[model samples]
Target: MTDDVVSALLHPIYVRLQETAVPAGGAGSEYILFFSYTDGRNRARVETFRGPTFADAWHRGLARLRKVVAKHPDMIRWLRVDTVDEMRRSNWAELKRQLTEVKRNYCRQGISLDRNCRHAFLETEINANAMFYGGVEYPHCVVNEKNFRLYAKLRHGLGDVDLKDATLVWMFSSRGFFLDKERPDEVHEIAGPGRSAGCRIVEALDDDLLSKVIKSSSTFLTGQVGDDGRFIYGWHPCFDREIQAYNSLRHASTTYAMIEAWEVTQDAALWAAIERSLAWLLREAICTVTLPDGTEAAFLVDVGNEIKLGANAVAILAFTQHAVVGGCIDHLPLLEKLAQGVLHMQQSKDGSFVHVLNYPDLTVKEAFRTIYYEGEAAFGLMRLYSLTGDERWLSAVEKAFDHFIAKEHWRHNDHWLSYCVNELTRYRPQERYLRFGIENVRDHLDFVLNRITTFPTLLELMMASEAMLARIEAMPDMRHLLGEIDLSKFHRALHFRARYLLNGYFWPELAMFYAKPQRIVGSFFIRHHAFRVRIDDVEHYLSGMVAYRSKLIGNSNRVRKAEATV
Candidate 1:
C-alpha cells in the first residue's frame, strides 16, 4: 500500500483520538494505534484505534467486530487477515518519512477546508498589519510553534514510556493495516482531487474541534481572566503571543463574572476584586491626558465606553452598590465624589444624560448614544438619592426625568426604559411620579402587546410590566389607571414574568407587588389618575432600595420609607 493511501484513512481518526483525550482540566494523555492491511494487488486499508486505555478499548472493539462477522459469512471474506508484524517491519522507516511529510505539509502551512478556500485550520503565520487597538502588550514573545516543538522535545528527552508507546503504535498502524481498502493506483489517481477537497474538509473539522475544546475549557475555567487580560477561549495556544491579551474583551467578560459573583456570594474577596477593577478603570482606563490649550481629553479605554452606556453604568453601579451593601458605607463619600464626576460628564442641560461622550473632555456629538446613557444615569442618580437623601442627587434625577418627559422618549418597548421607570418609582413615589410612571407603563405594555413577538422581548416586557404593576398597587388609588389594560394580556405578561423574570435576588420584590391587595381611596371620576404598590415586600426590596438610596441621597428614614413603598 502507498503512503498516501495509508494517510488518507488514518490521519482523521488519529486527530479525533487526540481530541477525545482532552481532559477536564485541559491536560491529558492520548494513545493512538494505527494498523495497516494489504492485498497482493497492492491495495491497503489503514485503521486507527485511539483512547486513554488503548489495549482495553481495542480488545472491546475486536470482540464486537468478531460477533458482527459471525452473523454474516460474506463479511468475513471482505475482512482478510494479513501479517501485521511483517508489514510493520517492512514499512517502519517509510511510515516515519510519511508522518514527517504530513506534519510539514498540513500542520506547518495550515490546511484549507473548502472549494472556496475561505476557511483554514491552525494558522501559524502572523498578519503583520493587525493593529494593537487596546490593552497592555507583552513584547518579544516566542511563537506557538516554538513552544509546541520545545514541549515535544522535552517529552522525547525524558524517554517517557507513554510517548514511546504512542509513537510505536502510530508507526505500526501506518504500515500494518490496510483499513482504507483502496488500491495504490486508485489512491494516486484520487490524491490530487482528494487532497484539494480534504484540505477544506480538514480545515473545517479542525475549526469545529478547536471551537468545542475552547467552549469546554471556558466552562471548566468559569471564564477566568488570565494575567494577559484574555479569557482562554480555544484549545490551540494563540499564535500571536504578543497580541494575546484580549484586553477590552477580557475586561468586559471579567466584569460580568464579578457582577454575577457579587449577586450570588456577596463574598468580600469578590468585592475587593471588584474595587480593584474599578480602580483599574478610573486610574488606568479612563485617560486624562491634557491638550496644549489646557483643555482636558478623556479616553475611556474600552469599546463599550465608545458605544454603549449600559456596560459602563453596570460596572459603576456594581462597585457603588457593593460599597453600600457591604457596610462600607464610608465608601459613600468616595462614591459621591465619583458620582459628581459622572454627573458633570454625563448630564445635559435638558436634564438628560448625553448618549456618548468624546473624552479627555466630555462632548456630545451623537444623539443616539444619549438614549441609553439617560436611562442608565437616571437609575444611578436615583440610587444615589435613595442612599444619601441628598437633594442635589434627587435634583439630578428630576432634571433627567424632566428631560425624559419633555422628549417624550419612553414610548418605545425598551429594557432601558423599564429600568428607568423602576428607578423613578423608587426615588420619587409621589402621586405625580406614580401617575407619570403608570402612563408610561401603559404605553410600554401597549408597545409590547402590539410590537414585541420574540420570547426574549416578551420576557423583558413582562419584567417591566411587573415593576409597573408593583408601583400601581402601592398607590392608594390605582384602579383608574388599570382601566385600559386588558386583563388577559396583563395576566399573560404576569405569567411570563413569574416564569422567567422572577428569580434570584429580584423575585421577592416582584412577588410582593403581584400578590398584595390594592385599595382605591380616591374619586373614580378624577381626570388625573394616581397609582401605588403597597409596601408589602418592603423588607427585602426596600433593603436593597434603601441601600441604593442611602448611597445616592443620604441616610434618611423618610426617603428610606418612600423607597420601601415605591
Candidate 2:
C-alpha cells in the first residue's frame, strides 16, 4: 500500500474511534497501522495496545491504529471490515480502568492551600498561569510602554539594550531592591520560571541585565497630583488610565499613603493633598449615594471588598484633629457634624461600635454589622468628646466602654480591645478606668510572657495597653502610675509596636512615626522624678501630639510617687 493511501484510510478510522464507547466493566482494545515510504523504500506496521482501564488503552490504541492504517491501506481495504464489535468491547474495558486510576491519583493528592474547594474554581486561571508561567506580574508592576518609549528616546538612543531593560530595572530599583540587602525570597522564586524564557528572548553581554530591567521600570508614585493643581508626585505610566473608583483597593492604598505622608512631613501641602483626595472620596468613591429617607450615606472600603470601619474613624480623626491643631475653627462645626454622623453609624445596640459595617449604601441598620465596628467607633467618639467637651460625646464614649464591661467580653482583649481600653482611659479619668487599664495591661503581658503561639496578637495588645497607660499618666490624677509602673518594659513594648506597624508592606509610615512621640514621652515620664512637678508640661506636650487631651497636673514628684506606692 502507498503511504498516502494508508494515511487516507487511517483518517476515517481515527474519526470513528473518537465517537465509540465501551461498557462499564469491560477492558478496551485498539488497533493502528502505519506505512512509511522514503524514496522508493516502503514499510507497513500494525500494533495493538492493552491497559487495565478502557479509557487509557483505548486512546493509546487509537494512536497505534492510526500509525498502522497509514502504513497499510491496501490490507485494511482488502479486509473489508466496516466496524468490529469485539474491538469496541476491549477498548471500553481498558478506558474504564484508566479513568479509575486517574480518579485514584486525584484522591491521593488530596487538597492543597491553593487547590481547596473554595479557591480551586476561582483561582483556575491563576493556577494555570502559575503552572505554565510561574508568576504573573501585577498591573501596578507592569511598565507603561508609551511613557517608557518616549523616555527612552529622549534620554538614550533607541538602542535595543537600553530600552529593553528600562521598565524592568526601574520597577526593581523603585522597590528599594538594590539599596536594601534583605530582599524577599519571593523575588528570586517568582523570577525563576521566567529566567529561561527571558534569556531566550533577550541576551546582553552583562549578567546583571535582569536586575537592571527591574530597576528601570516605572513606579506608581510618579503620577500622583496634589491639591495645589500641580504634579506633586512624579507621574507613573501605569496610572495613566482611570482606575476603578468604587470599592477599589488601589484607591484605599492611595488614601493611606497620603495620610502617612501628612504624618511624616507635617507639610501643609501634603495635608491639602489629603483633603483633596478626601473630597474625591466623599464625592465619588462612597458606595451608598442616597438613603431611603433621602439622606446621603457613605462608607469606606479597603482591599478585598472589605469595608474598613477603622478607616472611617481614622479619617474623622485626621480631618477633625487637623482643623483643631491648625486653628481652623471655622471648619470645626462642619468637622464636628461629620464626626457625629460617623459616630451614629458606629454605635451598636450594646453601646459598642461594630468592627465593620457592610452597608455599601451605608444606610443599613446597625444590627447587620460586625462587633469589631464598636471598637473603632468607640475610639472615634472618645476623640470627638476629648476635643469638643460635649457631654453627649462623653456619654457615648462611656456607653461604648460600659458595653464591653457589661458583657464581660475579655476574649476580645487582643489588640483592638487594648485600643478600646486606651481610648476610654483618655476620655474617662476615674479610678475604675485606671484599674481596668491595669487589668487589660496585665492580661496582655501574661499572654506575651507565657510565649503563646498567638504571640503577635498578644504583643499588639501589650503595646496598646502600655501606650494607653502612658497617655493616662499625661493626666494629673493618673500621673502617680508612672512611678509605680516599670518604664523599661513600657518602652520596649512601644518599640515593638512601632516596628510591627512600620513593617506592614502596603501602607505608609504614619503608624511607626505616630508611636515615636508617645514612646519618647513615656520614657521621659519614667526617668524624671521632676515629671510630677512638671505633669502640666507633660500634659501640654501630649495634648499637642495626640488628638485627645485631659486637663490636670500633679503638684510634686514625691507626692505623686508616694500616692502610687500606696
Candidate 3:
C-alpha cells in the first residue's frame, strides 16, 4: 500500500518532468521533493528531500518514511517535486533557517522530538508557506507551505489536537501545499503544465455546475447505502479500510442531505435508496416509549444503549424533509413522537437541553456534548413548525432562542442556529432573531472566505444568513439594518465559499492520485486526514451545495427575470 501510494503521487511529477528540458540526473541538477505521509489518524510525518534526481531524493526520504509507515501500515503518501531553482526563488533557505531555529528552541527547552514536538514542527512548517507566493513573475509559492497553523493557534488558541483535524490543499499552479483551515483556495495558477493547459482552474459555481456536483456527490452517498439500508459508513482510501464506527447523528443528517439532493435530481433510484435508509433507521435505531404522562415518543438509539440530542434533531430533519418532499405523511405520527422525545430532553426552567441520554431507562449520560446539538434541536423544532404549523414546536424554539441570545450563541458560528434563525424569522419576523442571524455569520466572513477545506457547514451558515439578509432587504422596516452590515462583503463571502469548496470534492482529476479512485471519485475528502471520505463529510458538502443551488442560484435567476420584465 505504501509503495502504491508513493508510486501514484510520484507518477504525476514524473509525467510533468518528462515534458521539461531538464536532464534526468547530473551534478548540481537538483530536485526538491516534498513528501507527506499519514496513518489516516493522529500520526503524520512530512519532510523535504533534495537530490540530483527525483528517484534519488525519494529513495533517500523513503528510509525515514519507511519507519513511520512500518508503525502505521495504513498510510497515505503524497510527493511533490520541484526544481532547485524554484525552491531558491521561493526563499526556501530562509524558511529552513526558521525551522532550524524552532527546533533549537525546543532543544534548549529540553523538549524531545516526540509526537507533540513533531506536530508543532509540522504546524510551523505549514504556517511558513500557506500564503507566500514568491513573486508575481514566478506566480507560486516556491517553498510549498503556509502559516495558517500558527495563525489559528495564535488567534483561536487552536492547539495540536485541534490543528490535527485539518485538510491539505495543493495549489496545482504553484505546487504549494496548504491546510484547509488556514488559507483560502483562491490562488494564482501560473508556471506549470497543469495551469498552462487550462486544466486545473475550477469553473464558476453556477446553477448548472452546482446541480451536477450535488447530484454526483449524492449519488456517491446513495451508493454507500446498501440493500439492508446500512451505510458503508466511510473509508480511509489510503488503505481502503471501511470505517467500522457509525453515529446515528451522522446517519440521520446524511439522510436529510439526500432528501435535499432529491429536490434537485429527482432521481427515483436515489429516492429508493432514501426509503431504504429511512426504513433501516426506523427499524434498527428508533424506539417508541410511553412517558409518565402517557405521551408516546420516539428516540433514535445508537449502539442499542445511547440516544443523542443531535440524533433526534436530525431525525426530525430527515423525516420532516422526507414527508414534505415525498408528499407522504406516513411519518407524521413518528415525527410528532420524535418531537415529544426532544421536548422531554429540554429543561422547563431555562430551555437548555440535555445532550445525551442512556436509552430505555432514559438516564442522563452526558449533559453537554457539543454546541451543535443546541442549534440542531432548535432547527429541528423550527423545521417541524414549518411543516405542521404547530405553535408548540415554534414556542419551544423561541424559548431555546431566548437561552441562545442570552448566552451569545452566535459566537459559535453554528450552521444549525443559522438554519433555525432563518426558519424562525420567516414565520415570525422579529428584531432579536434577525440580529442573531446577522451575528451568527458576520464575524466569520474572513474565515469563511479564506477557508481552504470544503468545510461544508460554513456554506450552510452563509446561505441561511444570506436568505435572512434578502428577507431583511425586502422589508421596508428592516432595510435600515443593512446599513450596519457590509452587505457586499457578505455576498462576496457567499460567492467565494460556494466556489472555493470545490477543493475538497473528489473530482476524477484529483481522486486519480489516491488509491481506489473509482470508489472515491464523487465523494468529498479531508485532505490532511489521509484524504478520508466519510458519510458525514459527503453529507455536509452535499447539503451546502444543495443550499447554494436552491438559494443563491435561484435568487439570481429570479433577479434576471425581474430585469427582463423591466
Candidate 4:
C-alpha cells in the first residue's frame, strides 16, 4: 500500500488554494489542490489532493490518472497552478451562449418540462499554470463546517470542489473523482461528455410549473425506494448515482409526501413506494415500549439505541395520515401505540416531551432540545387525538401551548407549530392558534418581501404561505395579514423556488454526463455535506406545495360557486 502515490491517499498534506472566481468563507483560501490532465486521446481527467496542501492528494490523484496519461502519453498538454475561477467563468459564459443558440434553433423551450430536451451543465478543472493565471481559483459551494477539510469529506460528484462547509448548493459545475465513504479504499470517478445548454430561472409564478416540479420530484423519489422499502439517502447529480447514507425519521416523512403526491398525480408507482417505505420502517426502525399498565407502544428510531423526539412524532403523523388517505383502519393499532409512546414522554409540569430515549438500558434524557422537536411532538399527539376523538391529546396540546408560547419557541424558522396550529384549528377553532400561526407567517413573509436581494428556499416560502393560506381559508379576516400581496404571488414564489432544489429532476438518462441514470429524483441535500438529498428535502417541498395547491383549488371552487349564486 506504500506505493508512494497510493500511500499518499492514506496520508495527505494540507495546502491553502486561492479562491478567485468562486467565493470563499472567512479565510478566503480553500483546502485541496486540483490535479488534472488531458491524455493522448484528448480525454480530460481531473481530481484533488486529499489534505490541506497535502503532497499525497496530488500523488494519489495522479496515480489513478496514469491509466489515461499512459494511454496517449503525448498530447497538447495544458497544466496550471491556476485556480478554477477562469474556467468556471468561461463555463458559465459558454453555457449561456449555448442556451441562447438552442433557444434560437430549438424554438426557446422557455423554462418548462420541455427543458428536458437537452442536458445543461457547467465544468471546472484545475489550472496548473499558476504563473500565467497569477492565482488559483476555487469553485463555489455553500460550505458546511466539517466538509471543507478536503481529506475528511470527499464525494463522487463535483470531483474536487468544496461542499464541506456548504449550507446548500443548487448547482455544481465540474467533472472528476470523489470517494465513497463506505468503500473508502476505492476511488469513484464522475466524468461526463460536454453538456449542450443551460437553465434560466423564470421569475413569474405559474401553477402549471409547480405541478410539473412536484410530479418530477415525486417520480425521482419513487425510483429511489428499494425492494425492502428503504429509500436511498443521497445522490450525486453529475454522476446520477446514490451515496451510502440512510435516515429513519425521513422514511416516515417521505411516505407522507408520496401519499400527498398520489392525491395530485394519482400515480400508482408512488403509492407502491409509500407502502414499501412504510413496511421497511415498521420492520426495521421501530422500538416498542411496554408501559406501566401492560400496554405496549411503538416509537420510530434512527440508528443507535436512541429515539429522537421528532422521529416518533413524524411517524405517528405519517401512519395516521396514510390510514386516512388509503381509507383503511389497519394501521390504527400502530398509530395508537406510537401516539401513546409520544404521550408518555411529555413532562407533567410543562407539557414538553422527552427528546431522546436510549434503549437496551432505556435511559431517558431531555436536558436540552433543538428548536423544533417540542412542537413536532405536540403535533403528533394532535393528529392522534383528531383520529381517535380522544381529549387526552387535547389536554397535552394546551399545556404545550402554555409552556412553548411563554418561551416564544415559535418565533424562529420552524414549521412545526404553524403546521400543528393549522391542523388543530380544523377540530377546535381557537383564535390563539390561528393568530399565533398568522404572526409567525406574517413576520417571515414581511422579511422576505422586504428583502430584494436574496430569495428564501422554496420549502420555506411554501411553508409560510401554506400557514397563511390555511388561516385565511378558515377565517377570511386573516387575509389582511398577507398585506397587499395576493394568493397568485405566493403561488409564483413556490413555482420559482423549485429552480434551486438540490436535484436535477429531469430524466438523467437523457444527460450525457450521468454514469448511471435511474428513474427517480433525489432531494433534501440542503442540510448535509455530501451529494446528499434527504427525504425531508423532498417531503417538505411536496407537503408545502400540495397543501397550498389544495387550498388554491378549493378557493377557486368557492369563487366559482359564489359567482353562480350572484
Candidate 5:
C-alpha cells in the first residue's frame, strides 16, 4: 500500500516532465536533470545529469532511476526529480530582478523571509515563476535560469557544483512538482494525492481527506502523552533531538486541542490520553491559593515558581472542553476555581490583566508577558460561561473587551482575540463588539495571505472571524457594517491560508528529506525553525483544520438544504 501511494505520487511527475521535456524553443537547448534518491533504508544519493540536448539529459537520468528501481524494487520508496532547460532563459534576468525586489519589499514591510509556506507570495512576486522553498530564503540563492546550481545546492545541500545554465526549473518528488519560470501564462503545477505542497489544488482539501488528516494528526499527538500522563514536549526532527524545556501553557493548550479533536472523532484511545494528560496537569501544575476575601482559587503553575495568565486560561479551556465533550460536569468546580484565578489576575482599575505572577504568594511576576494571554484568558472565560451559564464569565470577557477596544486591540490580529470575539459576539453582538470582531481580521488579510510560515494561528483567526462575519451578515441591522468589508477578499484569504498551510504539513514525500520520516511525516512542521514539530505546533494546526472542516461541511449542508427548498 505504501509503495502504491508513493508511486502514484511519483508517476505524475514522470509524465508531466515527459510532456514538457523539450522547451517550446526546441533544439539547441541544454538540459539539466537532477534526481535525489532514497530507499528508506539508506542515506540519500544525489545525482545530476547534463547533456547538450533535452532528450540526452532526460534519458541519462531516467536510465539511472530505472537501474536503481530494478535493483531495490521494494526499497525504492522516494525519488525527487528536477529538470530544466538551460537555453530557456527568456526574461530570466528581469525575473531575477523582480524576485530581488520582492525580498526587499518583504524586508521593508518587516515580513519574515522564511519560505516555508510562501509559494503563493513567490507566485505573485515573479508573476508565477515561483515554487515552495521549504526553508528560509537564502540571500545567496536566486531562482533565475543561470543560477540553478546555486539554488539546488543551497536548498538541498546537493554539494557545491558549478553549473550556470538553466531556466524554467520543474521540481517534483512525493508531494507533486511545480515549475518556476518567467511566464505567468505558462506556469504548470501538478498536485499529488492527498495534499499539494505548492500547487493550487482544492480537491485535496475534501472532507474525507481532511478527516483522515485530523485523525492521523490527533493520533500522533495522543501518542506523545506518556504513561506518566505528561506530554514528551516536542522534537527538532532533523537530528531527532528532544526539546529540553516544557511550558504549562502549551501542555494545557495542546490538551485543549486534543479534546477539540475528540469532539470530532470520539476515539476511546484519544479520550484516555486526554484523561491522562489532564490528570498530569492537575497533579503537578495546579495550586490553590487563599484569597484576601477568604475564598480560594486554583492556578496552573509551571516549572518556575510563577503563574502565567495564559497557563490558567488554557487549563480552564482544556477542563471546560473535556467536561462539555465528555458529557460530564465533574470538572465544574475545578473550572470555576481556575476562572477565579484568571479574575484575580485582572486589574480592576482599567480592565487590563497582569501577565505573570509569583506562585503561592500571588504577587506580580511581570506586569506583561505577551499579547496572547489577555485574549486567551478572555476566551477561557467565554468557554466556561458556555458550560455553566455563569454571568461572571460573560461579564469578565466584556470588561476585557472594553480595554481591547479602547486600546484598539485589533491591531494585534491575534487568534485568541478572534476566538474571544467570536464567542463574545454570540451573546452580546453589540455594535462596538461587532466592529471589533470585523476589524480584527479586516486589514490583516493580505499579510495573512502572503505570510511564509504556515503560522497556524492565522487560520484560527480567520476561521473565527469568518464565523463571526457569517453571523453578522445574517442580521438585518448589523449587515451595514460589512459594506466597507470586501467579503470576497476575506473569504479568499481564508481559503488561501487553509490551502497554503499544507506546505508546512510533512506529507510522506517531503518528510523523506528529513532525518526521521516515520516520526514526523503526519505532523505539521515549521520548516523555518529547523523543521520543528512540537505539541503546540500540531495543536494549532489540528484546531484550525478541525474548524475548517466544520466550515466546509457546514457550507455543504446549507447548500444542500437550500437546493432542496428551491
Candidate 6:
C-alpha cells in the first residue's frame, strides 16, 4: 500500500534510489554521495549528502531527493543518480515504469523535455555580444541586455582575483564574475540549484504562518521598547542583534504596524508597547509651532531638528489609529495641529508639499521635491477628515490629489493615493479618484503575473491591499452602492498576491544544492535578494496578510448571511 501511494505521487522529476558501498571497501569507511542533475543546459546542480557512513549518507541523500522532487517535479526525468562508484541495488524495472508515466503527465504540462529552467538564462548569456555600461539611468547595475545574465561564476564570493586580468567587473555591486577566454570551462560555483537562492520565490502568504511570524517579527520591535519608550531602530539579521541606526519614519511606521497588530490580536503587551512608543513620540519626536501666518501646527522632527512631510503624515495615521482604539482625545489636539501643517504646506495650484521644514520658524529646510510624500500627505489629510467630518480635510485631499494627477505623480508608489481615493469614494463618491486608483494599481498587474520578485515589498503589498479593498468596494463587497470600479488589471494584482503567498515558501526540508546550510523560514524575500530576515520584511507581509484576511472574512460572512436568507 505504501509502494502504491508513492508510485501514484511520483513525477518525472522523481529521485532515483542508490545502493553504493563504502568507498574504502573496508569496515567503518565513510563517504559523501553526490549526484549531478542538469536541466538540458550546460548548467548542472550537484547535491551532496555527507555522513559518517555510506549507509547514512545514502539514506540522508534519498530523503533530500524526496523533498526536492516534491517541490520541483520538472527536474525528475533529468535526474542522474546512477554514479559509477555506486552499487546498484534499487528496482529499476518499477522505476522505469514510473518514469514512463511521469513523462506522459509532464508532456501535458510542456515540461517533458530535459530543457531546464536555466536554459533561457544560459542561451541569452552565450549569444551576448555587446556590453554597455556607464549610464546614469542604467536601471540597477545592469549591462542592459534587459537585465544581466551570468558571464561566469565566482566561487569565493569576493576579492581574491587580480583586477588586471578581469574582463567584466562591476565595482558598485562588488560582482566579479568574468569568464577567462582561455579557461571557459573553469568558471566559479555559479551553476547549480544553490546559485538560484538569490532568486528565491514567495509562496502565498498563509494566515496561520502569518499569525506565527507576525507574533515573532513584532517581538523584535515590542520586546525591546526602551525604558524611555524609544524603539531599537535597526537589527542586524545576520548576527541576530541590534545595530545603531535610527529613522523617525521607520519608527513611526513600525508604531503603526504595532497598533494594527493590537487591533487584531488585542495583545496587552502590544498595547503597552504602543503606549511606550506614543510617549517617545510626544516627548522627543514631536514639536508644536505657531507661525506668524497665524497657523498653528504640530511637527514630528528628527534628531537633526528637521521635519519631513511623510513622517508627520504617518504620525497622524498612528495617532488617529491610537485615538480611535484607545478613545484618547489627548492626542487629538496634536493630530489636528499636524493636519494644519499638511494644510498650510501643500504647494498652491501644483498641489505638491515641501519634504522638510525647519519647524516653528516654518521655513522650508528642504524643498518639496520627492513623490512619495505627496500621497502620504494626502492620505493623512483624508484620514483626519474621516474622523472629524470636517469638509476642509476632505477639501485638502481634493486639492492635493488634483495636483498629483496633473503632475502625473500618481503613476508610481501610489498606495497612499489609492487609500485616499478609496476613502473619498466612500465619502464624496468621486469617479476620477476611483479611476485613478484602479489605473495606478493596474500597472502592478505584470509584477504579480511574472512573479517579478519572489514576494511583494511593503509598498507593493500596500498597493495590493488598496487594490483589493477597491476590488471589494467595486464588485462583490460594495456593488450595490456603487457600480464596478473596472478592476480588470487590478484583479491581477490580487491574483499575484495569492500566487506569491502560496508559491513563495522555501521550506528547509527541500534538497539544497548550496554547501552552506541556512535557517530561512517565514522569510518572504524579494527576487534577486539574499536570504536574510528583517523585522520590517515580515511586518509588511503581515500587513498584506491582515488586509487579505479581513477581506476573506468579509466575503465568507457575506456568503453565510446570503445562504441564511436563502
Where does candidate 5 have its weakest 10-residue lDDT segment? 108-117
lDDT of all the models against the reference? 0.37, 0.37, 0.69, 0.52, 0.71, 0.52
**lDDT (Cα, tens digit) per residue for candidate 6, span 268-383:** 88789889988899998888888568778888887677788988888888888888778887877889898988877887767668898875576888886566777778878877
Tens digits of per-residue lDDT for model 1, 1-566? 23343344344433334333321101223233323222222212223333456444344434544444355322321121111111112232333344443322122121211111112111111111011111123221212333333332432232222222223222111111212233222111000121121111222223233233222222222323343333332211112122232343235334433443354444555455555655555555554444445544333445434523443444445445665666557556555654564455544667755555554344554646545556656666666666677887667777777777777765544444655566667656655555555555555544444431222334434455556665676666755665655656765544433222111111111111111101111001000000111111111222222222222333256578889998
Reference-based TM-score of each model: 0.43, 0.41, 0.71, 0.61, 0.78, 0.63
lDDT of 3 by residue, 1-566 (tens): 46555444445445554344232212325554444433223223445555666567657765655565566555543222332222111123444334343321111111011211212222212322232322234322332233344433543355632212133221111232211111222222212332112113554568877888888999998899999888989997644679999887799999999999999999988999999999999999999988879999999998758889999999999999998998999999999999999999999899999999998988999999999999999999999989999999999999999899999999999999999999999988998889889888888999988764557788899998988999998999988777767889999998888776776776543443344656786788765354578999999888888888888667798999999999
Best by TM-score: 5
TM-score order, best first, reads: 5, 3, 6, 4, 1, 2
Model 3 misplacement above 4 A? 1-199
Model 6 lDDT at residue 262: 75
Q: Report lDDT (Cα) of residue 316, candidate 3.
A: 98
- What are the root-mean-square deviations of the candidates from the true structure over C-alphas? 21.9, 24.3, 11.7, 15.1, 7.9, 13.9
lDDT per residue as tens, model 5, 1-566 = 24344344455566676665543222434454556556544434556565766567666766776666666665455555544322222233444454454432121110001111111011111211122222355532244432334434544454543222333322112222432112212223534322233233445688987887789889989889999789988887655678889988899999999998987888899999999999999898898998889778999998888899999999999999988888888888899899999999998878899999998889888999999999999999999999899999999899999899999999999999999999999999899999998888889989888886678999999999999999988999999989867899999999899888877676554455455656776788765465678999999999999999999999999999999999
Model 6, C-alpha of 288: deviation from truth (Å): 0.9
The local lDDT score (0 to 100) that residue 171 gets in candidate 5 is 17
Model 4 RMSD, rounded to 1 decimal: 15.1
The clash tally of candidate 1 reads 50
Clashes of 6: 18
List residue ranges in candidate 2 displaced over 4 A.
1-263, 285-312, 346-349, 353-369, 414-420, 439-441, 445-464, 471-491, 497-566
| Higher-TM-score candidate of 2 and 6 | 6
- Index of the highest-lDDT prediction: 5
Q: Give the better candidate number (3 or 6) by lDDT.
A: 3
What does the lDDT read for residue 99 in candidate 2? Answer: 31
